[model samples]
Target: MTKVWEASVRATHSFLSETSIQKIKISLPKILQQIPDLIIVEDEKIIAFMGISHQELEMLFVAPEFRGLGLGKQLINYAIKNFDVNKLTVNEQNPQAIGFYEYLGFETYRRTETDDAGNPYPILYMKRKEN
Candidate 1:
């Protein structure tokens, strides 16, 4: 079970390598120790969870049968309300996620480029300003 999550996170990091996902993964233990607001979506057969760090929200995943049901938004909103920070980074190439964040009132603050093992990718730094 833990192996599955590690693999999912690794695959997610591979897909969003521009966000320095590997660094985030490496630092996850510290992050979890500091901010342990994990939100889970569960059913009879499966469960999905989102793990958050101080400055980043990550692992927003849903089971195949549970996609497009506003669960992601629910999890993200819960995090925003519970965590002290308001910043998150996303791979610029993931249009759906970009749109999702935008829909939740997170705006792009800056753009970053990453060189991960000779691969280059774009990332967006997004923030929800405090009121």
Candidate 2:
């Protein structure tokens, strides 16, 4: 799972410096341990995973090789159906992620100048549309 997370982040989070990536990598294990719902898709090895808590999608990552295969959508849809996941935060620099979430009916509700760690990277807070 750690390898998959690193690969996915390297592939998509171009805005993160190597130093920033390493810093996050150090704390990932703790973060993973804290999440209550860890949904994973595995085929021999873990291909993708998402964390859900209190109806919020805390994290989602697909192995770089498995992206664009609708796995992310499938996972989020499953979360919505079963776990009631609705809100999430995405890096503002990651337009691809923002677009993907928007395509799934999430709309930006707020913005933050820095990420949770107080980095310069901005974040977009989003919520799935109520229907």
Candidate 3:
């Protein structure tokens, strides 16, 4: 999880300080504990994973090497169809992620200056468009 974060989310998040990164690392265990459902794809080791609650996608991370192989999309599709999730938040700094979600038919409906934990990172609240 940490590795994937570094390669995907962290790499593009140039605004994050080392302190902020450390904070995320420290909080991961607690975050995982709070998630109700987690799905993982692995070959030799974990290549990707998605965490969810009743109707929200909590997390989705695909290892850098496995990206562009549609793992994230597959996980999201599974979440929407199986878990009934239709909304999620993404860091506004991650344009690639924003584009990916947009391609998946999600649209940003809200924006905030800080994240759910009050971090300085901006957040974009998105919901799937009804088709």
Candidate 4:
């Protein structure tokens, strides 16, 4: 989690300052309370994880060293098949993530100026396009 978050979230999510990251680290227990379901990918060590609440994909992160290995797409595929997941939000600043989801047939349908946390970062709301 630390490796993936530092590589992905800390790198792309500008709204999260070092202070905010520290705060988030301390608040994991509280955050876990809201997440009813989670998906994890592990080998010798934990490679990635995702948190979902119903059809909404709340979180996903792949470790830096483990990215580009199709782990993320595989996880999303599992979510789609098992959980009927079709919607998720991404930070507008993370073009790589946007492209990945777009490659998987997700299309942005809404935009928000602030995230659910009321942060100033823009969020792109996306849903899978029907085949």
Candidate that beats the other on TM-score, 2 or 3, i.e. the better one: 2
Deviating ranges (above 4 Å) for candidate 2? none
> lDDT rank, highest first?
2, 3, 4, 1
RMSD of 4: 1.7
- Quote model 2's TM-score: 0.98
Model 2, span 60-114: residue lDDT tens? 9999999999999999999999998889999999999999999999999999999
- What C-alpha lDDT, on a 0 to 100 scale, does residue 21 get in candidate 3? 80
Which candidate wins on lDDT? 2
- Candidates sorted by TM-score, descending order? 2, 3, 4, 1
Best by TM-score: 2
lDDT of 3 by residue, 37-108 (tens): 989887887778889987888888888788898889999999999999999998998888899999999999
Clashing residue pairs in candidate 2 are: none
Please list all clashing residue pairs in model 3, or write none if there are none.
none
For each candidate in turn, the TM-score is 0.66, 0.98, 0.92, 0.89
Q: What is the C-alpha lDDT of each candidate?
A: 0.67, 0.95, 0.85, 0.84
Clashing pairs in 1: none
lDDT, candidate 4, 67-104, per-residue tens:
79899999999999999999999988788899999999
- Please say which candidate is ahead in TM-score: 1 or 4: 4
Candidate 1 regions off by >4 Å?
1-36, 115-118
